[model samples]
Target: MQVRSLVSFLALAARLMLLGGLLLGGLAALAEDRPWLTAEERAWIAQQRVLRVASTPSYGPFTFVDAEGRLRGLSVDYVSRLNELSGLRLEFVAPEPFARNMEALRAGELDLLMSLRETPERAEFMGFTRPYVSVPVVLLRRVGSERQALMPGEPVSVGQGFAAADFLRQRYPDNPQQVETDDKSMLRRLASGEIDAAVMDLASATFQIRGEGIGNLRVQGDVGYAYELGIGYRRELALLGRILDKTLARIDAAERQAMVDRWISLQAERSPWQRRLLLAAAAALALVLLGLGLVLLWNRALQRQVVARTEQLRIELAERQRLQAADHARALAEAANQAKTEFMSQASHELRTPLNAVLGFAQLLGGDAQHPLDALQRERVGHIDAAARHLLILIEDMMTLSRIESGSLAVTPLPLQAGPLLRRCVELARPAAASAGIELRLDEAPLPLAQADPVRLEQVLHNLLSNAIKYNRPGGWVQVRAWAEPARGLLIQVADNGLGLSAEQLAQLFQPFNRLGRSEQQGTGIGLVISKQLMERMGGQIRVESQAGQGSRFILELQTS
Candidate 1:
């Protein structure tokens, strides 16, 4: 009987081990299926099997109720995936306006809110999951209008509860807001010109513009704000927040992209004719770009040609101007020469005739045999003759100077003996030196033959001798010397021990009609000027050396044969 009891115990032990193994296998499978949930989370979810979620009633593409009252949108699709992945039942509450839904969530009437932008104020009562959807906010305006920013005092419509509305309120507070119930209302107002512009999310605006057949509106630009949408639940439901966050993270990138493309692609919403129009526009743009490239190349070549031609024209203009200026200068010189010639001819005719007649009558009176006169009367006749002769000499000198300046005076330079020429000039100037009581001396040194016009050289030497004698004090001496230079050819010097010039007087010495304040002297002031010009015409130069209270030395240099 004891042996029978032992066999029964062994059978019971085998059955108990099999039952325990089966129970442990079932629990392991359950843990594998819901690895993201903790034991406490699972119990919490089991207690609250269905959670009520609500979103903006008319927000399209993200969350909306269809015309058939079916809950459908990007957020609904996400919740469907969440339920599939997490085994959590997230039931949709009846669609309501966003403000009402927000109030419901705050009042703890709703378990969760979909497509919400978490804010600090909202977070006080709610817990949020990581964002699952993002969309840019955009501006809407009439098709032809061009407003880039909100203007003060301008009415800009925005959806009442959208994050973009708050953004606009803070960013452009001076701009008045025409708060509308939703994006649809704001867009309608923008389309009808009741508001200047409207701000809303891009997806909803695009969906509504097409759905409502609002053809007069266009997306002006982005408003620099985007909606980072996520789920919001009561702050106490931390377990629910974690469950939702895990579910969101598990909805991989590929699945999220497919859902987004299905709703947000404008091409999917476009008609067949619109697609055809787009293709045609693409081809036209390609052709225009090709033509523009060709035009740019041709324009560059044309610009190079223009620049080359402009530079050429500039050079030609400068050359022509230079030639014109030269011709003008030459013409002016010729006119001045002609004027001088005419004046000299008139002066010779007008003054020389009277002076010659006066000299002739005076000479006739001085030698007349029929009129025997006293010594006083004879002296008076002598004075008249001297005055007339002086006037004649002055007139002749003026004529000679004018002829030399006008190039009418001919000069014929040749190799000439200097010694004979010097002796003859000295003899001619001796009587004047005697009258002034000045001694005129000539050096006996042998001189080289010099290149000069004979008559012009003689005239220059005679003028120098006359000036030396006339300006000298009593007992002063004048000296003439000549020598040959191996490099300089020939040099003749006429020096004077007389009233020497100061530094200031030397500066004005050669200027015509400037007498260096010696106006009382019997000289025309143009003699030195004429002599200097004549020497230059003969390929020679004349220079002076003098110091005040010392003496004056004048030197003439000429080239030799």
Candidate 2:
């Protein structure tokens, strides 16, 4: 009996010692005069009478109202701790909805809001505290969903004013969304099967499923983004934000973690049977790992053997494929060449027969001395002849394009007099310019001989001259200039004072059949294309420059001898 009394007395002494130490520690903490606060901050807090803080208790664990209708949650707990530590009086107002809270904060009815996302639009009226918490956004689906990913067409639900709503809209704008007033409403809709999916922060989803026991919904995956929560205050209260930041920085990591643990337990409680199943699964995994080691060693040796055999087969298969591919490519080339040759032959015959007839009859009538045709009759014949000649030129241009595409167009360059040839082209185009009431001006300086195919050079010059006259206004001017560059080569430019091209039109200027909105003009659309190709084949370059209201300039660069 004496030994038992001694043991009880020892236990009682231990309890008394622990209680005394805790009391002393509490008293010491309370005795701190200006702990973790600077003198300026203390003075500011003294002058600042009472800060009206507005918060919503609808968001559990973060902020929420209790049964007594008091604002209490993670944010509330922090407010209380901060007030006690700093000797600042913060008055908590009635619980308000999130939208109302923002409105009140903006209207100066409340000094600050507890926690909200910082967005660019909100920055216009309010300043934000440093991020205190980050909540990952998650994709929640029905429990038995087999989908590997969220489709853009699926119906989704998101909190109306959540930052995740903007993220979702950018990610899947085409998807239909049902915007709920809050996260709870979103989850309720998801549980009722009204929406296929809902995007919300992981913290709220966990509280709904684990804390509230809403078991029908499950988190499929994260939305790959997160919201950073912070204190929001009016822009006028910038100094207050700085003070809050300084105070929050003073809170130690251990105390902050303790506060978090006091509010949330992420891991849900498991039943006894479920705990046993988890243990059995762990044991099964351990046994499987043991057998897997032996199988891996055996598989490594067998894989080496199979790889050696596969090398020989792979080489043989590659050689056979290479030979077959070569033969198939050769056959395709032959077929394409034969088809092109046939097409060109048929096109040439079919187009020239009617053109030959029109040219033949018109020439005969225009030149006939027995009929002695009048001036008007002669002019009519001239129109027919010009039309027929234009048709013949179109056919030739098409044939040239085909040859150029097939790599069959040959360029035989010879020394040619640049000055005389350019002069002749200007002279030939003068009649067309005069008919169109456009002034054709030639500025020809003595230029060195150019190394180019004479026929192709003539074609390029004629097309540029004709296009200048055709697209010019009634009284515009076309200037033809030829000059020799010291080291670059000879340059020919055709500038027109007519409607110019835009940057977009200039980009596609040489594309085949791109008429540049001049479909009413009488010519094949491939003239510029043929011109560009002909210049390239003869080892020359062609380029153009134009502005919207000003006219266009086509520059052709040729090699000089």
Candidate 3:
């Protein structure tokens, strides 16, 4: 009877403790739930119909919670703007990975996704709004890295992945390419000069430039391009779609751009507490030296103050920086990976276009018993063979680009003078210039010396001179010049009276496979791509000036000795 009474007493005490804690917690929760809603917010939420929005987090500078735990950035801002404009009440929800998000929308658990890449494949599953932002998939590479090759030419490379593979299949199906999945393996290869370039998003490239301490890697132009980003929703949500379309359209282009600039800038700001923690650390070290003074000063009550101060200072600061850095890194890595996948796809398409024809004719010649070629047929076969060889060069170039990316090939150095090499390039290209009735002339003297592989230098000159001649009108003139000046590296130039470029075309000129109206000429569209890579490797720079229909001038600068 005594033992049972004791157990019952203990159980009753435990129940009272739980009841007392629950009552106190309820009061605290009530205090925290007080909402300071603005007149606009109250009006908006009052009309709330519970419009659920499922979006992927870590979609940085797009739809992410800020340091203060408020959802902000381009997409978030756009959506909030949308809510204000349309007076639609929204309930933000976590995005289910892959098809689950779409499935939720179908089940009416969600109204829409803030943004999704527009593609024909996705059209069946969802309705898309017209795109407001154009984000091209660009090559993010170490600035000094070589350009990727498309064919059998011995050249530097770009890394490959899903985007690159799809690009290859769509653009260059007949060409051969090597793909990579491991990241450390890719960078190690690139560092060794095996692969030449890596694909990455334009925005993420900036973070990489800062983080990797790579002064050279930069974002090239849109290679294969990317799917348009649009608001995605269930096709049945026609009423909601109509409301969003009107609201989204109100954001406009300039406003959208301003949002992007502001968010990216805000992302660069470090938490103020981070700096405070550093100061507190220094203060603690100073206090550590005054042992006797601190001991008496730090009673149990003083000890509580010290712990609270340090907690707010170093420990929390360290934790926040660690999380922020990790988030920033993940965002960029995902961007680079997407770029790599896109590059592979673009390279594939470019390779296959020529190979399809080459293979078609080679098979004809192989059908010996079925239908042998006569003299005319043999002549045609010869033409096809020549064309196939040219196509083969393109494939080799892409393979080499992969190898350069993978770090399997090595460069053989050659020494030579600068002035004479320019003259040789002029002489070699003179035939083509004459055929088109264009004059090719050497630039004036006062040329400086340069240390480089003579053959590589010649290749650069040849590309510039050829472009100047080919792109020019009949009776136009191409001038080749090389000069050295104090404080600047060796200056080499090729100017031409040609159909010039607008600002946009000039921006994209050196990107691989971007033909830029030179497609009519018998070329793989990688001449300048190769030239740019080789020049950079030799520690040189290539720049161009052009006005539409006025003419174009290409300037090459190399490091002086």
Candidate 4:
């Protein structure tokens, strides 16, 4: 008997041990399913004795205190679940006049706010949680009202501190007296016809109608956009943000859906009398909607017909007017072109006659060696010759420009030694450099032969050299450098230690008649313009680089043989 009792006792102990193991395994699984806060996070969370949260219990279904003086609403319930999970003591505080909640938050009297929309103004002092709920903003008005649309000067109402108010303010900037009130008060006033219409979120409007028996009001239409509700905390509470975000992430999605469904069920339920009234109202609304739709279709048809007729008439009139106007404009343009061509031709001939006579007489007087004069008379004669020559050069330039514009300027391309051509140009410019007390340097490296018209190339070199000497400050230096590059072939740069051009001046440098605000320089403003065209004619390009107060570098690139 003792041996049997011992075996039975051992089996009983084994059974109890097996039962305890299963319980332990189930507890471990449950713990793994729920997330735990880190040790440091829990320590940080524990430092807060109590978190003072602000709630304006006036907006029901979203947030409000029941008649029993118990805070019971969607936001309240949601925060309670968050509090239970986070292990923080949340003390709910209510401030009168609702808007003071924001003031308390700004003043640091409130640590958190429930169900608030994020805005630029609020974001200044508060950090927001991820949006937990979203609802459409809408316009509501009394049922059976004849007012289908808001009349001018009729006052509208919007929820205070809400995006709908700002949207309306922007949409109707001319109307400044739009009433600002809470959603509940606005709905109450709307039902009593104190305002033409009120703006609120769809959920709140529905809750007011079903939960509070605000059955007199019906939705007119949506306001601009939906409002997304989120929890707002003071910006100083960064740890709070992290903690709340983590806790919110761990919340079951179904649990949140259940919360939403609970509130929706409460907001959707109606009494029997209310349902009957709604059914009757819905029937009437359907007829009104059908009538309005038919009227809209008819009006659209008539409007389209009128628009088609007006468009046809307008097209015919426009075609007739356009033909007449085009004919008149063509005649005027032809007349203007002829006048311009005639003026240029006659003016060039008339001016060249006097210029030639002056040059001829000046050369004769200066070169009369048989009737030699004194030094003063010689100098005076030289001056006359110089002025006449300058005038003759100006005439030649004008004529060349005329030919260029008329597309008659000829170009003859041939291979030429770039070294000798450039040397000759530098020699010709030496006298001017000496007169200006400027130093001229030349790079005598063996340069590749270039494909260009010798005469046109020489002309281009002369213009570059002259401009370099003319613009260089007295006692400054001018350097002529040449190099060779593949494809581009040969490059010659005329760099001067003279006043350079600014970015703004460089932009207009090549435009005819633009001297870039240079009144002191003697320039017709077309020298660079003509030079650019000539270089292109010879299959070359010329560009300049400069900076203020430094110097200028003009690079000429040409194809070589």
lDDT of each: 0.79, 0.78, 0.61, 0.75
In model 2, how large is the Cα lDDT of residue 170? 79
**Count of backbone clashes for each model?**
0, 2, 58, 0
> What is the TM-score of each predicted model, taking all chains together?
0.44, 0.43, 0.38, 0.42
List, residue by residue over 1-561, the lDDT tens digit for candidate 3. 999999999999999999978865664444333232234343333444677787643344456544576665566777777766555666678634434566676676787776566555555667766454544445445555454323333222333322334554554566445455423344445545566655433343343344344444444433434434568887776555545554554554457667666654313434699889989998998778788666776686556655357557888899999999999999999767545633543465346545866777676695676777788887877787777877776775564454334322223222235665566667889898999999888866865456454545666777677778878998889888778887777788889879999998988887878887657777667777877777777677788899999999888887665
Q: Which lDDT value does model 1 have at 323?
A: 100
lDDT by residue (tens digit), candidate 1, 375-401: 999999999988888778778778777
**Model 2 TM-score relative to the real fold:** 0.43
Per-residue lDDT tens digits for candidate 2, residues 233-337, read: 888986677677656645644576677677755565789999999999999999999899989999998887653566888999999999999999999997787
RMSD of 4: 34.9
Worst 10 residues of 1 by lDDT: 406-415
Clashing pairs in 1: none
Task: Give the number of the best model, judged by lDDT.
Answer: 1
Candidate 4 — what's its lDDT? 0.75
Q: Which candidate do you rate higher for TM-score, 2 or 4?
A: 2
lDDT of 4 by residue, 82-137 (tens): 87788767778764445778888899998998878888788889987755665666
Which of the two, 1 or 2, has more TM-score? 1
Off by over 4 Å in 3: 1-379, 403-415, 444-446, 517-522
